[model samples]
Every structure is written in structure tokens, then in C-alpha cells.
Target: MDCCSPSRRQALLWAGVAAAPLAFAAAEPGAAAAAMPKDALLVTDAEVVTVTDSSVVITWFTGSATQTDRYGAPAPVPADTELLLGEPGNPGSTRTVYHDTAPTAFHHAEVHGLDPGRTYAFTARSAGQDAQQSTLQFPGTGGSSDAPGVFTTLQPPPGRYLFTLALSNDLHMGEQTAGIITGNWPPAFQQDPGLPPYPEVMLEALLDDLRKPDRGAEVLLVAGDLTSEAKPGDVARVRQLLDGWGTLGTDYFVARGNHDRPHVGADYAACTPIPYATDHHDCWGDVFPYPRQTLSVHQVGGLRIVGLDTTTLDAAGGTLDDGQLADLAAELRRDKDRPTLLFGHHPVTYESAVTTAAGPAFDLDQTKARQLEALYHRTPGVFLHHSGHTHRNKRTFMEESQSVEFLEVAATKEYPGGCSLVRVFTGGYQVNFYKTRADLARQWSQRTRGEYYGIWPHYTLGTIADRNHTVVRDLSGLTALRPR
Candidate 1:
């Protein structure tokens, strides 16, 4: 079936329902449920992903069927809300499977002929109750003469603009080992006590910080390794973590990383090297599928953000395949004039001796790196490539191009409780690394006699400022970097 066809759309709706067993239970009437008041409310996890003068996709979810009707002038309400499937806008009513569930009780509806740079306050209703109401701002253009509704609209400032995004990686949800996991056998794996399962903890803290009014970051891009061992339970845990943060307005995107694949064997290292196993492949597909890529020609003011899935090879380390690379090239070609930022799990290039010592090793495919570099050179917008793996704080500038910056992020687990906060402004981009609030860093430092290699000690500062012009910043006060 055509994936974009109407039938395929129906299938997507059913898939949502099949995955949510708890939603089904909540929908059922119970003795206790009868006592609770029933008011029509929109059951939605709605958030704004991308916004422009002409279009927007406000993604949301619902417990049951809903209706999108106009209440006041600019706001919408439920006219005749009920649990109905496949009725006009209600594509979710016909399917019994969980996937059939819709993000909202309804899907995308175009608010056509909208005035530029206007703010519209819209609400959703389910079971004849108001579910959610939020205002969306549209950037206006110069030539528009018509105004549709009495809403406030603002246009983006003229000339080039910069958008800021947050980068995080190697969450490793259920993984037991901080370093490599080597032991007698599978049963021996039971003996290994993991260093710290703090990925979730740090993620929550980092998110909380970002949600602050002053953070100014509107987009979040996770480079990959969201879970350890690609187990369904682990994937579910990661989902719960993200779902908890759904309220934040940051638009989130993710790419598949090495550890995100299912457990193949003790030797199975990167998700890109081997074909996925039977049960495990589905889990990965269901949780962290590849091509989670997003491209914004005008992300953040005028800059473009290109998110790539570099770990598409197999279970082992590999770069993007030829077809994916071609697609990437096409995308770059489309927006060659805009400054572009690349986000992915693997680095296009690196020169780290310490990471080389690790078993599966660090470094992107040399041939692929050169290919991508050539593409970047041809494309004017490509300025920075952000990656995370080999959990360490490091930055490398390609001498060949001098135009591209390769930034490696520290893992969220291990010693210095890894978290990086990135801010973009009209001047330039600033990245501040914060040590996790947990005392694990100090404890590890004391126990290892300064030999703690798991977490680097130099990122303890509450903030770090990066001037747009300088590639190197004085991190002296931020965190002391130990000599390699």
C-alpha cells in the first residue's frame, strides 16, 4: 500500500490505539469512573513543531474521538463531539487497532487564506468538553492586504536570522555498563552492576533548565543512542521520559545511534553494522526508527537545520547509505544559500586517540567523511556538525574546509553528569555544559584518585559563553580539562 495513501493514513491511526493499552482502559467505564464528572475536554498532547506564515502542523493525541468546531471568532470548540470513527475529519473512528489512534481526535486541518503574521488562539474539544487552547504566532510578509481574523500577527525581522537548538546524546536507558560490557558470558552479564543509570535523571534536569523563560532555545535535537540494548521496555522508558517533557514548546527530533539497536550478542556493538534480529528489529522500528531526520530551510530566523540518520548501516558502525546520502545532497542543494547545522550520532570526522582504544572504536567512515565534506563545501549553509559518542567533551575543526566545526558532546551518564545547553541568537551560538546535580562526579573523582576516565571533569560550570566569531573559548573558569 502507498504509505501516504488514505488507507495508509487509516493504518497509522490504528497503530496508535494498539500501542496504548492504558488509554483503552481509561476509556472504559468503571464503578469509580461513574462517580467522576464528565465534561467535554480535548485529550491532546499538542505542541507546535514548525510554524510559518502559511502552514503549521500542531501534533496532539486524544483518549477518544473528538470534534473540531468553531466556538468563538478565533477559537474553536466541539459542536457535536462524540466517539465517532472515519466520519469526515474523524479518520480514527473506523479502526480497532491501537495504531489507528490519532494524535488529536482529529488530524491536520488547513486554516487556509490566513493573514500573515497573525496569532490565532485555537482549542480542541472531546466528549463535548474543551480539551486545549493555545495561541500560534504567524510571521507576516510585506505585501499582504487582507486580514482574516482579529488576531495579532508579527513578521520575522528582515535579513539573515539564527536559530538555537539543544543537543543531547547517548541516553542509554537500560544499559548496565558505563564502559564496555565484557564478562564470562550472557549469564555473567547478571554480575555486572552498571555505573549509574542517570541518563533519564540528567535528561529531566536539562529539560527543566531549558524550559526556563530565559533559555531561549525553541528546538531540541537528540543525536541518538536514546536507549541501551534496544529493548522494548527500555524504549518505552525513553518514550515516557520524552512524553513527560511534551509540554515544553521545544520541537524535538532524534536519530538512531549504535546502542539503540537490539541486543545481538556480546560482540554486537553499533546498531549500524548488523541486520536487526527478529523481535529486536520491530522494537527498534517501533521506538527509534531511522530517517527521523528533519530539515528546516528557515529554522530559527534564517539558518537551516538538517538532522541526519548516520547510523542506518546495521548493528555495526556505518555511515548513511548511498540513497540516503543522495537524498541529503538533494536537500542541501535545495537550500544552499542558508547557513545549515547538521545533527547526527556519528561524527563525519574526528582525530581522537583515546576513543580509538575503545573496542568498537570512534570515527566516521573516512570515504564517507570526505564525501560529506565535499558536499558541505559545495553547499554554503553547512557550518556546524554536532555529534555525540565516545562520551567526552571535544571540538575539532576541519583544516581542509575551515568552514565546518565538529562538536562532540559528553554522555549524560558517568562522572561529570553530562548535560549541554545551547543557545542561538542574532550574534552567534553559545553552548554551556552543566555537571549533573548528582554528587556522582565528586564521588567518582574521590574514589579514582583523579584517574576517573568515565566522566571528564571540565564541564562543571553552570554556564559557558561562546562568541559567534571565535572557534575556541576560554574554558578555564568553566571546567579544568585534564591532559590526555
Candidate 2:
């Protein structure tokens, strides 16, 4: 709700940008003209997002409305936006990506036809100002570390053919926390939810996208944190929205999140509590009727997916007691060759530059993470771990384990708002993030780009398939199953 408008530090915002003087100027402190000229309209908060092997997007803000807080969204800029691109240091080779006719602050331009593992240069001119001279670096294996602004592209998947799965998380139904609950941003931003409750509207769009006749996804996977405060109304609301997709427990699968864990609330206490051996659940005991158990297994597309309740009674992070770990270990031992994926709310390991929610509570505790890593070491069938707590798109290849691919999906309800569609090919699997197609989802995503020091959107929304990725896996175990 911290949607305050600010102005100041307009020069500081773009001062240390990665420009090398080809198109943007490097500001020197104490120099009268060298500084960003207080009144000058220069590109600030420029970034590349939604990157893929064939394309990349560049965005920036114009105007003097600077963000003065560490964790809030700023209002849209007061001008139109445009961008220019070309070979680094060569303006003549430049081509225009696109242009905006309307005067809007938050501007983005997607440049297509980029080769994988290649590098090119470009400049973003918006608000009548140029951002740091940047390069369109594609992803490739084993590149020089010394190269500046080099981005690596994911390798192709292992095979081809098969059904796909849709994955999403952190819907945070009924919570007012901005980033924690998508679409609940500051009022000053003036982003209309299009439909009354923005979260519900956005979630509906996500499900709608998954049901598209042409979408390859055959199963729906909700990682966790389905509700904000685990309210009965909120849980019911989420269930109602999900009903649009199909019958629960069959069309889609879910796991528990900290926010959905059992808690003490009079309003949510009416339903009978589900039985838990350790008494660690909240109102969830009575909330969710299907997938009745936190630790449950489901089969889809010939893959065995495990959902766990990592949330402890009071910790923000998750805990895997010795007993639970042992059980998981035993499960893997039973069918070591099954194509398996584990879904939970808190990630095993999450990295974020912004101190949005600081604490070990933000991720799996050290002991649990180590245990999971050790478990992954021997579980070759485990190809992926999908989690949601961080509400950002991050794919970490567990080099040590060399088996599981860990992906942190963006929140479904807010900034960088969208869900990930995973296309499972016999050769390999590819995950592409998509914002809910509703106009409200688009407006909220653009408006909240200023969250977490104005650079928040860059990470949550992901840069160059950073949020979207393709992985090569030993899917021979799945070869026996045909796409249903």
C-alpha cells in the first residue's frame, strides 16, 4: 500500500548505469554539466526482461518521479517512451525496436531475431532520454567471465514430444501486502484491477491461459501460498476461482505454503481441522478439502510429483524434521528411477539482491537445505523442484547434485505477475513465464516495477528467459508413458 509519488535523485538514479559513453553520458560528481542535469529527462531504471534465445526486452522510466523508499512502487512517469538499438558503439547499424504513441512513463520494447549465445549492443531512448549503453548478451555454455554484460542462454532440452504442465504460486489470496500479494499495490499508482478483486481477476486469467485450446499444458501445478492469511473466505475464494479450470485433485494439484499453514483465527476456525500428527497446521485443517494431506503424491503426465508442507508452526522459513526427511528418502528409494518433482512453498535455496523479507525464514533453513541437497545427490529421478515463496523467477542448476533443477516462480497475483507454462518434450522441457492476459494484470505489472528499489521488477519479471528456461533431462524413465 506504499504507493507514494516521489521526486529527487533523478540524476542519481541513472548515474552509474552501464553506459560506456556511446549513447549515454557518465556523470561525474560535483561537475555542473556532467551530472544528469536536474531537469533533464533521462532514462532511469533501464533493464532487459522476458529474454529468450530469439528475443529480448528493454524497459525504462522517464520523468522526475524518483522512488525514495526501499520497498514501494512509484507512480508511472509523465512522458512517452521509445528505444534505439544497434551494434555496440556503432549507431549506424541501429534499428528501431518499436515506439509508443501515448505519453506513458513505463516503457518497454522487445527486440526479436537475436541469435543464441551471441552478443550485440543497443541503447534505450525513452522519456526523450537515453539509458546506459547496454548489450544484448545471449546465454551459452562456458563463456569468458571477464566479458561485460554477458548473458547465457539455456541449452536445448533432451528430446521431443509429450504433454506440458502449468505451474504457479504465491497467489496470496485476500492479503493486502503489496508484493507478497500480487495486485495489491499502492493506490496512488491508479491501477484498476479491471475486475473488482484484482487477485481473483488475475488468478482467473492464469487459469484461462492454461485452458487455452492450443496450450500444450495438460496438468496444473500450484506450488503453494494459495492464500494470504489462510482466511476461510480467502481459501473458499481461491477454490471457487480454481473451479473454473476443472475438477480439483484431478485437473490440478497443490501443496501447502506457510501462509496456508494452520493458524489461530476465529473466522477460519469453523471447519473441522484436518488431523496432523505434529499439530503444526493452521486453519488449513478445515480450509482445503482435497489433496487432504500436506504430504501427498500425485501422478500426471507419467511423472510422480511430491508436495510437502515445509512450514513449521511459527517459522517464516520451513523445516524438514528427521522423520519427514527419512520418509522422503525412503520414497525415493522405492522408485529411484521415476521422473519426480517436489513442490513446496519455501525454496531449498533462494537468492535475492533486495532485502525484501530478510531472514532464514524466507527460504528453507540451512539444515533442511543441506538435507535436501544430500537427498538430491542420490535421487537421479528427481529432475525438478518448484517453489514460490520468493515470488520471483529464478532457475538454479544444482551443480553439486547434478540432477534436480530448482525454479522459483513469480507470484501469480502481483508484480512480475504471471504463471509458468512448462512444455515437456521427449527431448527436454522448456518453461516460459506469461503474465495473465487481463488488462488489469498488465497495468499492475507495469505500475509496480518500482517496488523494492525500482529494480524489483527486473528480477521478478525475469530478464531474457531468466524466468523462462529450457533444461535437458534424462527422461528415459518417462519414455514408457504416452501423453494423456
171-259 per-residue lDDT for model 1 (tens digits):
77876534332331111111113644445555665666566653445566777788776667777788778766652223666766766
Q: List ranges where model 2 is wrong by over 4 Å.
A: 1-44, 57-90, 97-114, 122-155, 179-195, 208-216, 274-287, 290-293, 321-323, 350-357, 397-399, 434-437, 452-468, 476-484
TM-score of each candidate structure, all chains considered together: 0.52, 0.73
Residue 19's lDDT within candidate 2 is 31
| TM-score between model 2 and native | 0.73
Tens digit of per-residue lDDT, candidate 2, span 255-297: 8787776665465456555466333334554546533323767
- Candidate models: Cα lDDT each: 0.45, 0.61
